[model samples]
Target: MSVTLKLATSLDGRIATAAGQSKWITGERSRAAVHQLRAEHDAVLVGAETALADDPELTVRLPGYAGRQPARVVLDSRQRLPTTAKLVQTAREIPTYLVATEAPQARLTDAGVRVLQAPALGEDRPELKAVLEALAREGLRRLFVEGGGQVAASFLRCGLVDAVEWFRAPIVIGGEGRPAIGALAVAGLADAPHFRRTEVRELGDDLWERYERI
Candidate 1:
């Protein structure tokens, strides 16, 4: 299975402002490109915190695009994803899966969400290896990770990320803003995860950088 992490952030690598506002980080063209990327992947995955904060539909919304929508998967270890969330509301129409350490919640299951269990790791987070295996069994081999920092870091830390599609805006959000990636516990430069830049181009005011794990 291959995992691609998508990041649409400011030039300073900030995904959002200090107040947690993240809408429209990139321009129209970049956003449209993301929709295309969604169509290419088998499933789009995010952490529970991102699902709670953004309430994203994770659907491909290109103009007049009638292709099969990718499945939406959320890493919600404690079953924290709300039943009222958009993913849950449209779970029956678009395959939505919730990976958690706990048993399936009645509300979520009744809402038509498929719950998968995975072993917990640090801070009770779902283990990445098992999560990927479970997803692979469901025939979701091409995974797209749309994140909110911690999720991106988790995949990098576990060496699960195969490629990266980074969209960088012209503006900078500065140090006070939220980072695009969280702590990876790299004690030295050599310990950091490295990726070889494969492509770079401009999409409107944003720069799309593609990288493969080296």
Candidate 2:
């Protein structure tokens, strides 16, 4: 499966403030572009922290556009996603999946979520490659990974990310702010994951940058 990681951050690469308030980092145009990106993909995914923190719908919300809403997927190794979340509430209408290392939860399953069990890593997290394969088995070929740092870092660290769609706002948040990506423990320049910039353009006040894995 082809995985594209999306990032909406401040100029200094921060996704949120020091207190973790991340709403409206990018302008309206950038968000609309993100919805368009979601519509182009087969499924949209985010980590458990993102699900619990933001409680996003993960749906394509373009005006007057009537198309298939991309399947919503969450990397919740322990099945932490609440059934009250918007994604769960409207799951019967839109395909919703939860990837976990544990057995499927009945509450979520009854709420119309399909849980895919994956092998666990050393930290008890679902193995990335296994998760992708499971998702592929369900016919999700194009995966859009919208993140909250750890999720982005996981895909990058596993060399699973095929492309990146990054949106950067003009505002600056210093070191105290939350980073857009977590630490990869790159000890040398050669060990770092590299990407070739494919495109760059302005999306309102935010700059949208696209890159392909190198």
Candidate 3:
């Protein structure tokens, strides 16, 4: 299984504004590219923080692209996903999975969404590697990870990311915003993953960089 990490950030590497305002950060072209990637991937994954903050529909909504929606996967280690979330409400049609702890599986199943109980990272956090392996076993060949920083960092730190598509916007959001990549528990530079830049294209004011893990 190949896992691709995708993200859009400011020129200064900020994902959200100081006040958490993140709408329209990237232009239409970038958004269109994202939808195309979503349509190509088997499932789209995000962390609980992104789910709560964005409340995105997580569907491929490009013109002439109807009826092609990827399965939505949420990493809610503590099972903190809201019942009224768009993912849950549309699970019957698009299939949403809540990757959580063992205790929340029953509740999530009762809510009509498929639940996968994986090993906990701490008391409630789900192990990232285990969750990815399970998804791979379920025939998820191409995993697209869209995130709010921490999730992207987890995949990169674990050396599980096969490719990365990072978009750099023209705007500059100062401090008080979340970074493009969150902190990792690294000992030194020797632990860093090498990436070979594959492509760099400009979409209006945004710049998109594609890299393959080396």
Candidate 4:
């Protein structure tokens, strides 16, 4: 399965301010474009931080396309998702999958959500490649990762990212702000992951770029 990592940042590559303020970083056109990208994928995944911070629906919000919403997946190893979250509340409408380890499968299913058990990474995150392979076995052909940084970095560091659709707004957020892609502890430049720029376009006042793994 092909994986696309998508994120919008400021001109200086900040996804959010130093205080974690991230709403409306880009223009309306760019946000709408993201919904269109979500509709094209089989499943859209994000890390627990994004889920906690945004409480996002992660569904295709485009008009008249509600039924085509892809599966919503979250990498929440501890199963900390609250039932009040939009994804959990509307689990019946759109398929919501929680990737966790040894979670209460019965309880989650009772709430109309599916659970995928996997091995943990670091303190409380699932291994990305295993999660991807599990999704592939379930017949998911395309996975889109709409991020909150650390997840994006994990995928990129593991060489699991097939492409990136990065959007840069005209405004600049200083270095104190949170970066678009989180840190990867590469010892040198040669060890760092690289991608070949494939396309660039202006979406409203934002710069939208596409890149493929070199």
Which candidate ranks first by lDDT, i.e. highest? 1
Off by over 4 Å in 2: none
Q: Model 1, residue 203: what's the lDDT?
A: 93
Q: What's each prediction's TM-score?
A: 0.99, 0.98, 0.94, 0.95
Q: Give the distance in Å from residue 113's predicted Cα in candidate 4 to where it truly belongs.
A: 1.1
What is candidate 4's TM-score against the reference? 0.95
Candidate 4, poorest ten consecutive residues by summed lDDT: 101-110
Ten contiguous residues with the weakest lDDT in model 2 = 119-128
Residue lDDT tens for model 1, 1-214: 9999999999999999999988888999999999999999999999999999989999999989999999999999999888789999999999999999988899999999999999999899999999999999999999999997999999999999999999999998899999999999999999999999999999987899999999
Order the candidates by TM-score, highest first: 1, 2, 4, 3
Between which residue pairs do clashes occur in model 2? none
Q: Sorted on lDDT, highest at the top, how do the candidates line up? A: 1, 2, 4, 3
Q: Give the TM-score of candidate 2.
A: 0.98
User: Model 4, 23-49: lDDT tens per residue?
Assistant: 889998889889999989999999888
Candidate 3's residue-wise lDDT over 80-176, tens digit each? 8877888887888887888987656555677678887789876476888899888877777788999969888888888889999998899888767
Local distance difference test scores for all models:
0.95, 0.94, 0.86, 0.88
Which residue pairs come into collision in candidate 1? none
- Give candidate 3's total backbone clashes: 0
TM-score between candidate 3 and the true structure: 0.94
For residue 186, model 3's alpha carbon misses the true position, in angstroms, by: 3.1
